[model samples]
Target: MAAIELRNIVKVFSDKRRGRDLLTLDNINLDIEANDFVCLLGPSGCGKSTLLNIIAGFEQATSGRTLVDGKQVERPGSDRGVVFQQPTLMPWLTAIDNIAFHLKLKGVAKAERYDRAMESIDLVGLRGFEHHHPSEMSGGMNQRVGIARALLMNPSVILMDEPFAALDAQTKLEMQEELVAIWQKRRSTIVFVTHSVDEALVLGNKIVVMTKRPGRIREAVNFDLPRPRDITSPEFNDAKRHILSLIREESTRLAQAS
Candidate 1:
């Protein structure tokens, strides 16, 4: 069975001032297979994040259906984990503590929580800094903690919304490499949302490009480029050029409509 299935999904929001409802997602349908790293890439305001949120069960669609693991998604559940653009860790909690907070909330024994948290900490390459608080760490380190926290849940799916967007260029590259490695090792289904063409190409095995609001699927480009991909290589540039052309065409269409 598909890991996730979205059939004819639609989302609408009320515009009180205008006295009209605005459609955000329009008849969207997608099937994400297990262990697939899919990136939703598009221009700003394309409702990519909204689509991710619906799948995460943070929001419900106005029409159609969403299923994860062949089960209907009603509300937020432990089966899925989310990592946001900012590392929303508690400032006072140590890295290990922050990663294990969910377990603690569930009344897990301290020893077991620490043990599990340690594994994720090492997974994100923050073993030695486990005792450091969020304030003591760099932006990248805090984001690593966030990723570890989510991974520690062992959720079937991980939803990331531009998690590395706030980091410096070098740090972003490092996090991206580490994230891909973790995904390879963990082999969990991931739906990542991003605006960068290169970022989408570098990370996703499948890139789902969306049209501007009211968002619609433009294409689902399969990208199986080898890891540690040579960005300057012809194959890489060729893929980038293809996506660029798609974006350009989308822009031209919108321009003409306006």
Candidate 2:
């Protein structure tokens, strides 16, 4: 069964200032398989993140429907976890505490919350820094905390909107590797939004490229490249070339329309 199903999704935003409705996603239909690492890749403003938000129930589609685990998505639930572009962790709370805050809200005991949070902390490689607050840690570290927090929920689907976009190149690479490892171990469905082709290539088994503006799935390419993919390899280069061609074609079409 599909982990996520988006059927004929149409999202229109009311542009009050412009006195018009802007359609952001047009008739988007997609099915993400269970435990699939799918990357929604496109240029900025292509509505990749918007589509992810719709799936996460942060935004409602103007038309059509979304289903996860065979049930329609009506609102945000614990079954789907989201990691935004920013960490969004509590500034005053320590890393472990921030990760465990959800459990605390659920009335889980102190010892239980700590125990649960520790598993996630260790998963994200933040064992020694568990007591550090968000303000005290680097952007990458805090983002790790955000990811850990999401993992602790054990959600069937995890939505990440450019979660590593803000980190340094080295940190971004490290995080990508770590995320792939985590996914392999945990095996949950992940829908990641990003405009970076290299990032998509490095992380996703299925790459769904979107067109500009009113985003449409241009193509869904499946690449089962082995772990620790060599960016310089012929097969990797071939896949990258194909994706770049698609984006370039879209750019030309958009330019002509404008």
Summarize candidate 1's per-residue lDDT along 164-209 as a digit string, tens digits. Answer: 8889999899889999999999899999999999999999999999
Q: Candidate 1: misplaced stretches above 4 Å?
A: none
Model 2's TM-score against the true structure: 0.98
Number of the top lDDT candidate: 2
Worst 10 residues of 2 by lDDT: 97-106
The 0-to-1 C-alpha lDDT of every candidate, in the order given, reads 0.94, 0.95
- Candidate 2 differs from the real structure by a C-alpha RMSD in angstroms, to one decimal, of 0.8
Query: Cα-based RMSD of the predictions, in order?
Result: 1.1, 0.8
User: What are the per-model numbers of colliding residue pairs?
Assistant: 0, 0
lDDT of 2 at 214: 89
